[model samples]
Target chain A: MTTAKRDTYTPETLLTVAVRIFNERGYDGTSMEHLSRAAGISKSSIYHHVAGKEELLRRAVSRALDALFAILDEPDAGRGRAVERVEYVTRRTVGVLMAELPYVTLLLRVRGNTTTERWALERRREFDQRVADLLKAAAAEGDLRADVDTRLATRLLFGMVNSLVEWYRPQPGGGYEGEQVAEAVVRMAFDGLRSGG
Target chain B: MTTAKRDTYTPETLLTVAVRIFNERGYDGTSMEHLSRAAGISKSSIYHHVAGKEELLRRAVSRALDALFAILDEPDAGRGRAVERVEYVTRRTVGVLMAELPYVTLLLRVRGNTTTERWALERRREFDQRVADLLKAAAAEGDLRADVDTRLATRLLFGMVNSLVEWYRPQPGGGYEGEQVAEAVVRMAFDGLRSGG
Candidate 1:
């Protein structure tokens, strides 16, 4: 018997399937045929919802980029001390990554082989630069350590955060939540792995 | 006139060229023809050195995996206090990642769509588990913080380390070296981002 889940598919639903396929098969290796087979939809139906694979990629990466860019505009990220602002952005970035894990995973893996991929890479760099600026200001304020380079610290901090995509799988009734993970990230970034000072 | 570089293309040398292409084009997206064109050699010549693209992938990933596994067997990593051992592994991991950047980059991005990809992933997980065991022992020894889960901390630590693949480029006389980066990583990870902590 056919699954009832296949009865109806919107562009948004089609995108969810496409992104999963894209993640499984490297985006360069995936095609419309793969999406159609995964979604249990016809190629015409897939095209009817979206222009093509590139459009699906654009839509997927945009979801991740939009969520990330939004974090920079939040009052907490802008109205506080640079160090605090960096912390705020770091926490929210982790939250967004956990929330939008698949899309961001795809975003992080883009190789700049296509126009859509190149655009995603450029936007990601812009986001990283904005956060790097916050890190620079924190260093200038003497709130951050002098020994570690601000640019290197910024990369490491986000690297730790962006890594959630690699292994974090959400559970319906799991013990860990995004906020708790964010708290741990902030503590680790600010205080470190060792207990106490 | 042909460059002197083209004069010799041993399997090891050809594997380097193939790995770069595998990284640029996703492994599944790459083929014998792609490797041939990239290496300035014919498909037959490429085959003469290595069996196929998968063999090249195997060789490259084995290089990365071998380097990483060797770290666990190092005297410093084996004979220290749990905390110190973890630190040693962490520092050496960053060094190995830098020295084998392209190979590890391809290793990290493997999607597990093929048997070789799946094997690479399994070996990576095995390595992560070994490191995680070290982190767990450190926590049990009361050297690490109790607040953060050991598993979570292990993931974050490596996440920060693994991220070097995204942006690190080696220079013959670069301002930053792997050991320096490793020191900063250990500092940020053990001490943190705030000043005078």
Candidate 2:
């Protein structure tokens, strides 16, 4: 990318461009040239922003992990009944996923090949375990169904939630929203198909 | 891979090793050196077996696609009631996934970077549409609930099922077999968390 004298590129803006390119071209398939082209800067300018492509991966996954863990710190997530806490986290997760779509998409697609991917995988497991603990608490409190295993339920729930990254597209002109999707998810997951009426 | 006079690798056996490496290192991240090391052969010998990495990917996804489409031809899947056929397809899919775990795992991970990956993606959509049509048929028969969108249910069901590849490990000695797991999946997808009793 050709650089202009006026506005300097910070690591953050450069990273945003890098992550989008990483997603478009699978991370392994992307190169310094691709990032330079996508960022509208030279290869040297790209290196000046971040050390390399791996650094860009590290920064993107860090953003996703931070947002996910932050959900556990919210008041509703920490103080509610176990079932309610699960629901709250579920809703907030959908929001975080949409708000930080590129980062989370990168995090999800990681194959644990590099240092960044392995770290991302570990943090992702921690996030899943936190939700599993919430499910365990719900089960113990007699709120959730007793038949399905808690760990199984947690995986199934997150499987459904994470699947959103596969199909969810933001609306133009402010049409569709993640909140409505999250609410439907909670209802279908908690209540099941038998009609809770 | 220097082809020695005694080179004895078949396409099928070479494919097995190649697909495993592909899944572990990812299709794009893996190189000829990695494949040669994994197969315990020379880089040239690798080509004697399969054309290239993309060809291996095509072969693997073909195995997965064949197994999945074969489910549609089964008498139970083709001739039964819509709800029954849906359950049959779900059961058979779980079986196919377990039986062809590595292939389908690779198939699911394809991101459309190459012609083979794009082909896999198109076939995946076709499979999803077939299942969605089953859901539509069931809804038309007034057996399944109509409040929820059939397409949405199809996505969720496959989301949970496809997720098995991410985490499910079969017992090395003896435990639940494919049929039992398929039964549980069908049960969970249809009757759901409610007491089916």
Candidate 3:
């Protein structure tokens, strides 16, 4: 399908282009012109796929948020012992983030300048609170350390997880491998670097 | 020095307002007009203290970079076992981040959009590399866990440090201080939340 036929761009493909441009130019720095240029289409052509820039942002963050929130719903995440649930959420989160790298990367970088961004941030906080609750439960169950504040521990745990977007690049060779990295993160986080003899 | 005398804002005072705006609206989001409103001064008044927005950013990030780079020069940071030095830098880096929150926040948020920002990012990478070296040394000393890559550890460690900008608000009651937070960060980093036992 070329100009001869019909090569209609979907909201999904447009979003892929938009997130990359947003990451490259930043959400605020990007303009319709930038999106048009990156997408190989005219500015007017973009309105066909999505409402505007904000819609693209909303879609991108929504993907990331859904991926994150869905972690809470997973069987392993929901039915495990509190500590196991926390670890399951942690592992799947790193996997989700890596799988949905571009979308999650955009979500992590939002600054709450617009309604979409603020909504995204609120959802992020909600997600954090859910994790914090798990941590709290784990501590109460005596599965996790009671010495640390659950809130602080949750933040540091996600802090390590979310930092992946900053520097993690998927291998150019196929297969989308991530579990190895996730395993390392879990071990480094829960078990500490000190090897027990 | 009464109200009768002409009132003017010093560069230091102007920066406090400017950095807040920068952190909120982003360096690129801010305009001379935004600064004027935030500082309760005319747009022209801002020019008197600094050249323009980029100059303001350069000054702010320079201050932050200076503090971090100086950590490498400290006796405690430079001396002792590699693991100790790594811990020393982590604790002091947290303190530096908290003490110079606005400046460090500005530095962390800068993208390579302008010359000032690119320069700041380069310098930041250098600082990161220096810390990464400390992690490498600690790993070589067989102190750090061998399983996780030192580079990944360095990124996660700094990620823990840099995330302070996102949520840490200094207390109005002054009971919770930066040093206390820094201590907590160090404790959590070296020893797992599970405890020394």
| DockQ of prediction 1 | 0.65
Write down the worst ten-residue block by lDDT for model 3 chain B: B1-10
Q: Which candidate is the best by DockQ?
A: 1
Cα shift from native, residue A192, model 2 (Å): 3.0
Q: Give every collision pair in model 2.
A: A1-A40, A1-A41, A1-A42, B1-B42, B1-B43, B1-B44, B1-B45
Clashing pairs in 3: none
What docking class should model 2 receive?
Answer: acceptable
lDDT string for model 3 (A1-197, tens) is 11222436788888899999999888999999888877778777898777899999999999999999998988898896887788888889999999999999999989899999999999999999998998888788886555677777777788878888877889878523598778766766666555451
- Per candidate, the number of residue pairs that clash is 0, 7, 0
Error of 1 at B4 (Å): 15
Per-residue lDDT of candidate 3, residues B32-112 (tens digit) = 988888777777778888999888888889899999999999999978889889888988998888889899989988889
Candidate achieving the largest TM-score: 1
Model 3 captures what fraction of native contacts?
0.29
Candidate 2 Cα errors over 4 Å, as ranges:
A1-7, A25-34, A42-55, A113-116, A173-176, A194-197, B1-5, B28-37, B40-55, B79-81, B113-115, B174-184, B192-197
TM-score of each candidate structure, all chains considered together: 0.88, 0.83, 0.86
Question: Which lDDT tens digits does candidate 2 get at residues A1-197?
Answer: 36534336899998888889999887888999888777777788877777899999999999999999999999999886788898899889989988898889999988888888898899999999999998888888877656666776777778778887887778866634576677666656776533332
Ranking by TM-score: 1, 3, 2
Q: After superposition, how far is residue A75 of candidate 1 from its true place, in Å?
A: 2.9
Choose the strongest candidate by lDDT: 1
Task: State the lDDT of candidate 1 residue by residue for B17-98, as single tens digits.
Answer: 8888988877877888777778887778777787788888889999999999999988999886798999999999999999
Off by over 4 Å in 1: A1-8, A41-48, B1-8, B42-48, B113-116
